[model samples]
Target chain A: NAGVTQTPKFRILKIGQSMTLQCTQDMNHNYMYWYRQDPGMGLKLIYYSVGAGITDKGEVPNGYNVSRSTTEDFPLRLELAAPSQTSVYFCASSTGVGETQYFGPGTRLLVL
Target chain B: AQSVTQPDIHITVSEGASLELRCNYSYGATPYLFWYVQSPGQGLQLLLKYFSGDTLVQGIKGFEAEFKRSQSSFNLRKPSVHWSDAAEYFCAVGAWSPDKVIFGPGTSLSVIP
Candidate 1:
């Protein structure tokens, strides 16, 4: 299985530009999550979905939005990119809350 | 709220030497703990996790962690270090219920010959 997959391994966006980061999992997990990791720092949760059509905000969800249309897909949307949003974004999935999370390769974003 | 802390920013150890990475967490109840390793420019990979059962948990790559509830610490240890083990390690904590998993800053390990 692909475990988890993300698109556009790397991207560079200008301020105010918008983009969508796609994430897909083939493990049929019920829980999915979006997180960002800054240089020399740990990951911070941006958003998560318990299942299809159900999503919720995470610790740092201010500049991001997410939609889970199918159990295999969860996409994060950035309405207006900023310098602070320049970081590596990771998508993860798990069978349940507090369970082991399988992570994707991550998308490196640079906002200029 | 749950939080995790890794006291050491970076550590260096000679090949075949013992290694240890410290982690501390704060939460109201018993937390689900995890240790992950990330190579440069790569994604995080789970090394091990602690839910209940025994306090000592074994992980991949000859790594193990001991959970100490009294000190709120879950420290990762390896009997012998390898050059390939050089990477950034992160400790994370989560609640039993639906909650965000909190990750520590991370500890960068460097293995020397």
Candidate 2:
């Protein structure tokens, strides 16, 4: 099964531009998460969903939003892109709490 | 609050030499630990995880980690290093709560011939 997949491997956005990063998992995981990684740094959680129709903010959720309409999809939305938002975004899914997470090949965003 | 830290930012070892990457975590209770590897321009891959049972946990790619509760540390080790082992390693700590996982700054490994 395809563990997790993300769209638009790379993107460049101008200031104030908005976009949605797509993530999908076929493993029927109950938990989905969005994280961002800066150069030479670890990942910081942006948002997560425990299940369909339930989403919550994570550590660095100031500039992002998320929705979990179905168990297979969790999308992150950026209302206004900024330079600080330029980072590698990863989407992950897990069976439950404290379970192993399967990660997608991240999307690299560049805000100019 | 849960947090993780990798003391060494980068480490270099010759091929066939022993290797170890240190990780420390802070949590109020017993924490679930994980180690992940990331090759350049690639996604993260789980090397191993420590949930319960034996303190010494074995992982993929000939890697193993020992969880020391008293020290609040989980260190990854490999008996013999190979060039293919060169990658960035991240240590993470989490609990039963959703979105509570915390990742440490990765430690980059360089294998020399």
Candidate 3:
């Protein structure tokens, strides 16, 4: 079973470019999350969803939006990417509260 | 509000030597703590966590973490360092229920042969 799968393993976007990073999990987990990792910054939560159609803002949700159309899919949208938004994005899911989150391979994004 | 602090920005250890990474958290209530390791170009992998039960928790890859309630710290330790263990380690904390997890500035581990 594929735990979590992310698309567009790597991408480069110019200023004002918009794109979506797709994340899907086959674990049928109830909790899904989006995070970005930067040098020495560890991982900061971008957005999260408890279940389908129920998304919530997280610690660093200023420049992105997310949608949870299905239990297996959670996609992040960057309307106008900026240089600061360039970071490795990760998707994760957990079976339930206080559970270990399984992470996807990650998508490397660079905004020019 | 909840926060995590990884005091060590970077650490260097000789192979076969013991290693420890410090992590401190500040939360109003009981905190759920976690340690995740990230290799080059890879996503974060769970090493260990602390929620309840025993204070000491053993995790994969010969790593372990001890939860100290009084100190509000959950420190990760390895008996011996391995070359493959060189990576960035993150400490995180959150509420007992699912929500946003606060992450500290990660500690990068370098193992010398």
lDDT to native, each model: 0.93, 0.94, 0.91
Which segments of candidate 3 are over 4 A away from where they belong? Answer: none
Model 3 alpha-carbon miss at residue B76, Å: 0.7
lDDT of 2 by residue, A1-69 (tens): 979999889999999999999999999999999999986679999999999999998989998989899
What is the descending lDDT order? 2, 1, 3
Q: Tens digits of per-residue lDDT for model 1 on A7-110? A: 98999999999999999999999999999998667898899889999999888899899999999999999999999999999999999988888999999999
Q: Rank the candidates by DockQ, best first.
A: 2, 3, 1
Error of 2 at B79 (Å): 0.3
Model 1 chain B weakest lDDT span, ten residues long: B93-102
Model 2, position A71, has a per-residue lDDT of 99
Question: Model 3: per-residue lDDT, tens digit, B1-113?
Answer: 46788999999999999999999988998778899998988788999888889999999999999999999999999999999999999988887565657889999999999
lDDT of 1 by residue, B25-90 (tens): 999888889999999877889999999999999999999999999999999999999999999999
Q: Give the range of the ten consecutive residues with the poorest summed lDDT in model 3 chain A.
A: A37-46
Best model number under lDDT = 2
DockQ of each: 0.74, 0.80, 0.75
Better of 2 and 3 by DockQ: 2
After superposition, the stretches of candidate 2 with alpha carbons farther than 4 Å from their true spots are none
